[model samples]
Target: MKLQDHSASLSEVNQSVDTTVVHKSGWRKILAFFGPAYLVSVGYMDPGNWATDLAGGSKYGYTLLWVLLMSNLMALLLQSLSARLGIVRGRDLAQANRETYPAPVNFVLYILAEIAIAATDLAEVLGMAIGIQLLTGLPLMWGVGLTVLDTFLLLLLQRYGIRKMEAFIITLVAIVGISFFVELVLARPPMGEVVTGFIPSLPDDTALYIAIGIIGATVMPHNLYLHSALVQTRKIKKTNEGIRHALKINFLDTTIALNLAFFVNAAILILAATVFYKAGHTEIADLHEAHRMLEPLLGTRLAPILFAVALIAAGQSSTVTGTLAGQIVMEGYLRLRINPWLRRLITRLVAIIPALIVIWVSGEEKIGQLLVFSQVLLSLQLGFAVIPLIHFVSDKHTMGAFAIKPIVKAGAWLISTVLVYLNIRMVWSEASEFISGNNPWWIDGLIILVGLAFISLLVITIIYPWLSRYRMERSARMHPTKVTLGSLEAPSYKRIAMALDFSQNDEKIIANALAQGRPDTEYILIHIVESASARYFGKEADDFETRKDQEQLDTYLALLAGRNINAKGVLGYRHRAKEIVRIVKAHDADLLVLGGHGHKGIKDWIYGETVNYVRHYVHIPVLVVQ
Candidate 1:
């Protein structure tokens, strides 16, 4: 229920760090706000961005540079809003949505956010693996396996403190920047053409698709969650002046960091443009192709080496933050906690399995396409994160005096609308193309069905808030003054049933049931024998199993009688869950008490769990005593 309880531990790690600088007004004080944005900027220039930028530049020769610039501008605005939300409201985007939205809305948003994170991680994992493959001679699968171990090593650095981790990330970012800068100089792109490329232009449909990829890869969804939470790590005072100052300083940090990301992205495009496109190597859309061609085209081996090093740096850095984002999303949305290592492993495996499959089946050539597809998937889930962010920040109630300016709110809405439109357009374009391809009729039908389903989900996501508001208003109007029982009375269970497995834990279950039941309560002790004889013999097996269970039930009844508990016993032949539900309903029982061994792992799965089944089938509340 508390804010901290739902916030990610990564953000909580260095929370309230150095809060005593409110009176200071120098650049030294502003330095305290620099780390979070750099951490976020890593997402902007990750290896996924590399694939898109490389493709855009080599294939179209800087014509799609406008897309990267536009996406960065969008990133800057959204990330600033994300940081403002955390600073002004003291809640991350996930926590804000969780507190503001209804359960169903929150549940849907949580699912979308998770999908976005997984998609983001999918790109990061592949990027890191490809970087590994490029740097070393290892297979792509081996490189992916290596990434899992390397990520754990990087995460262990967090134990040194968040600042150290931030410093490490900045160091990697610097490496990427310097590597690209060096490549830019070696490639020697024409300034006039580069400037022309900056002007917004799309040559054709292929350019539009690649431009969308650039946007998707640049303005990531997970970074929004990550930045919002990361800003909370700082210790700013909870005052209007303090918040205003924090926002201004954080904006500067975001601007500087993201511009650096822009430079890195642009440098990637410029390198590809000058080195590949100008040299008539228009087919160099793939990262590996670009890497191989850089050496021969640029007439220097260092270019490819620097490219690979920068890639590995970008991939490694992004992987660390990707893991952090996974943890943040999981904890924020689901309010569930697992060991950080375990959570990372689960997410990594989810990504790794598919990456390995693609590598094995499709080979290394498909990695670039997979990376681009992952980014587009992130784009699909972007609206779910973006709309809620704009809504929360624009609302007077949520933001109070710190609510976004009218112009800013309008701009945010414009951006959200554009993103939503682009996503729908992309989906339609892709679906139409697929349907028109050489696929079978049934496959076309399936594609159409999936597109309709996706559109339906999008419509629901957009309209859920309105539906919730209307439902609440309708309920209020219909109910008027709701009546309630305000008495502190214990609930009575007149007809109670206890399920016994005849285990050693049965006594504890019986004791617990007695503790809750009144003296006059009727308790039915039931046990079902899952007799193997029922498969081989019919009536004889049923009678034999019934008699055996009856003796056990009689013994339980005698035990209950000795304790002065009014009770009866029943025995059934097979189908434990069915018989238990039948007895509960037949007796009109209010509650069911069951003995639970709390079995786990394989044994729990294979032997089945009776209490779970009964709880699902019956309306009565079933309590399991472990």
Candidate 2:
């Protein structure tokens, strides 16, 4: 088998894509569609939601419960639409946006989406750190610093497959759910009053502001990008029936997952209402204060303990999904893929640095404000994501028969309008407060300029689809004949290089390398000596491993010589991929043959991904044999 580069969405986990949902029926089939939504659902109840829900319930005493319900309903509809785009169109929100819009537009969209993810991650880092501080009595700064370690935890879980990662998230969700369930039991909130809280009434401006915050924070912008891509992980049939079945099952999955998220959010609000508002602690907003007051008001130590545990669970789960969203947006919009660890580390650090700076400069009292600011950042991007999603799923050319009906489209539009309006109101309120407190004229002017630019982008995004449709129709009528191109023949190899491990695969590598060469073509046998001394001394190292590698290369060259082949031996020290690439370039070889060790998952981490490094760095045709 020959290896080649594949630019699949979430290419690191491409092995899991389209491999789990094949040839199953009933519950087994339904289970395959269950995971993606769970991943998306975690975003709905992330640390960002905690601040808003806690604030609403404490300040308004369950009067804003209706907002959570309304937000949940909107999330279900929007998320289902997102999944339909993936199952029917095989494109994520980011990928669809890239294809639909111009390059500059997509670049801005990509940056906005990335900023939204970083903001979401900032909330998670703060929440997780606070939870650790609450539970272990550790300093908040240490807790914030320690949150960086979970990036490796994410890397480790990913090795097992998507199902394993899903299981881990589900476990965390359960912890949050069960923790709140116990808290509600302890608080014993009045059932009649709690039900009355959902009657859709805002008593004052404070209530309205909190209501806007609840709605704005509930529908995460990144989750829209994430759900559309995640549903493509399963392989379904190509027929209408297959698409329909996949859509139906995925809707069920989305409903269940998001409703569970609703329960978590509602429970947080209810717990806050019952414990804080009932005791006249209406100003409670900070998570640390909430946890501290829980023990005293609920009259049980367990209440505070469960609260801390649930917060940690929520933070951890949200961080995983946030990193995935970052990856999807970066790859989908930019077509750039990097090392997964490096990507995760970059995201975590982006969030972590801000968090640590806040902790060090302003202290833990400011974390709640930071969390709210992150939600505001998300609010700024919500319209940019939701409007495009609606346009894509409603487009007949892209969705075909899977295009949403007129009524569904109307409802999606109405929901998008309401969400965008409320988020704008919230963002404006936050911005006004900041501007009022600020001192510099340039800073205010910059904010105004950015706001105007944002509106311009939003306008262009809304109208571009119709404009693009018209342009296509006009072009098709004017130019009936389609453009065509001719294919070229394969090139002949003049010089080939075989990178050897001096193992059982050397002979196989030689055979494949020889097969690609012409009769008069020259070949170079290459190997790298990576011993302890060789790493320090380069080619001057005199070590047993170096001598052994040299002898192995000589034996391979002699074997090729006996076959009347034009071959020479070349050996280098230090890094495997770097040495192979350098030696191949120095010898002026046009082709490089490498043996695939079939390393994957943890083995890939241990042995290093040399083939990728060599292929990416060298400007030649690479043939990887397995």
Candidate 3:
């Protein structure tokens, strides 16, 4: 019994060790795999989300948390579809849609999506600048000035691979996540109220308005587009098991980061609720009020400072996502290649103009109104962007093996419809502030300018397709078949040579079939001995050789085995250079072709005997194929 007991105890100890090993290994796996999705999460936590959450919690307390849960699930389903499309096709979302849709429809959808990305980007810039003001006590204008510093940040992104950028953003996300985690615990938000918020009860008119803001904020279109495009940056191959893993990793990544986002969003709402709900705080505005009011409630130094730090992180990280999204939108839609720096500068300048103007003219009194307005526009534009993602992902011609199932399509459509309905409701509510206000002179002036700007931008966004089609038609009429890239090839050689280490005739057959321009060119086969004497000695003779001789033999054999081309090689040395020149002279050879790495410089040419002898002595037109 004692021996048996010892054995059982040892077995238990072994089991415990095995469990410990598994736990450690699992943690390593999780960390190693935790990329891509966190990058996607940045868009979810963009300044737009913070502004919406601030508005929601301040106005309705815990009444609209349900909007976030539903919106995030919707975001996940849509982004996943886009990501799956990318994985299967190995092309970004915009390009795939362009190929799949009719030219007119594709042009329209591309322009609308690009505008949506730009609008989303504008939110990121404003949010980052706001966070800068909160964190550094800079004036709003100076904080906006610091947005230019993002150009430097973009430099770091290019110098280091995007993996480094992902890490930097993930750290920022962790800081934001931890700040909210602490704030949520300290605020001691009512569990019962939080639960009820998710139950979807009808609120008063104020509650419904706040609810719309929350939904709009949570469901930005660019996040779907960014996630879908970003997944292709990783080394996801187009194999079945590999694709399945990519999908799984994307989901896990999105879930982890978005779950943190959900908490961060809820924390902002809960903080606002705890500090300002129904306290007769009718006109509290700006991140300043958010901080100062919360200071008295959640202690002084940590909570408010953390709030600012989180805002800064959210805004800065989002700028990177916004920049990349802008690049994709331009490349995929406009087919115009501009410097990334120029693109970012243009976006920042335009986006910050409104926010800067708001802070200047209306002061903090209207920032709340501005956040709601921006978010509602974002919600409205998202449908235009997301509906096509669903359509493209479901199209059998496009997605092929990875076409979204019927149920997923149904869910995506339902989500898009609900969001469209919410945006319409929100836009109607927001339009009232500009149109129906009691103020007289400045109100009318502000209303006219803002309305014109809003309508003009919206009209441009909607009518871009017609404009694009007109331009395309006009351009086609003006020019025809403008050849692109390397069209200056001489007539395809009747005979071609492929240099081989161990290649077979299979490639020669294909290359021969694929040879362009001249199909009936004479094919010549030739092999060279190391020296003219080697032809008499056979393969097993004395191998005293010259540089030109060795080169001629290899080049000749390759030319023989490769594509059908009229070319041959000969064996000779000492006068070998003279001999090859003599052969070219004798055959009246039109061209000599040599295969190589992309190097044709004097450095590679002079060091190797074959290249050295062939290049230096031969006078015929020599073509180098890389």
Best by lDDT: 2
What are the per-residue Cα lDDT tens digits for candidate 2 across 247-288?
Answer: 998899999999999999999999999999999989777999
What is the number of residue pairs that collide in model 3?
Answer: 4
As a TM-score, model 1 comes out at: 0.73
Give a tens-digit lDDT track for model 1, residues 1-626: 12234333355473646644657667668887779999999998888888888888889997888888888999999999999987886667777666556677678778777777777778778877777778886888888888788655654665566788899999999999999999988888889888888788878877877888888888888899888888888887778898888999999999999999999999998888898888888866678888888898889989988988998889888877877777777666666665556777777888888888988899889988888888888888888888878877876765788899999988998988889888888888988988889998999999889778667766766666545543323221123466787897989888788888887878887887777788899988877777787534533575566567778888888877898889998765557788889888888888889977765444544777677578778887888887
Mark the regions of model 2 whose C-alpha exceeds 4 Å error after superposition: 1-7, 14-23, 427-444, 470-490
Best by TM-score: 2
Q: Give the Cα lDDT of each candidate.
A: 0.80, 0.85, 0.63
The deviation in Å at residue 92 for candidate 3 is 2.3
Decide which is better by lDDT, 1 or 3. Answer: 1
Error of 3 at 49 (Å): 1.2
> Could you give the candidate ranking by TM-score, starting with the highest?
2, 1, 3
Task: Compose the digit string of candidate 3's lDDT tens values, residues 1-626.
Answer: 01121111111111111111334575554454456678777777777787778777777777778788887787778767877766665555655445444566667666666666666666776677777777777877788777887876675564455567788988988988888888777777777777777877656766666666666677766666666666666553457766776677767877877787788887887777766774645444356677777777666677887888888888888888777777666555545546556877887777778877888998856765776666666676676677667766776754576788899888887987786666656555676765786778888787668656544544443445334432322221123458567768566555433222223543543353235325555433223443566655544445665444457455654764575544444433333334445555555555554444433333333434354456556665555544
Candidate 3 structure, TM-score to reference: 0.66
Clashes of each: 0, 0, 4
Q: Give residue 113's error in model 3 in angstroms.
A: 3.0
What residue pairs clash in candidate 3, if any at all? 495-564, 495-565, 495-566, 496-565
Q: By summed lDDT, which 10 consecutive residues of candidate 2 come out lowest?
A: 470-479
> Ten consecutive residues with minimal summed lDDT in candidate 3?
1-10
lDDT of 2 at 401: 89
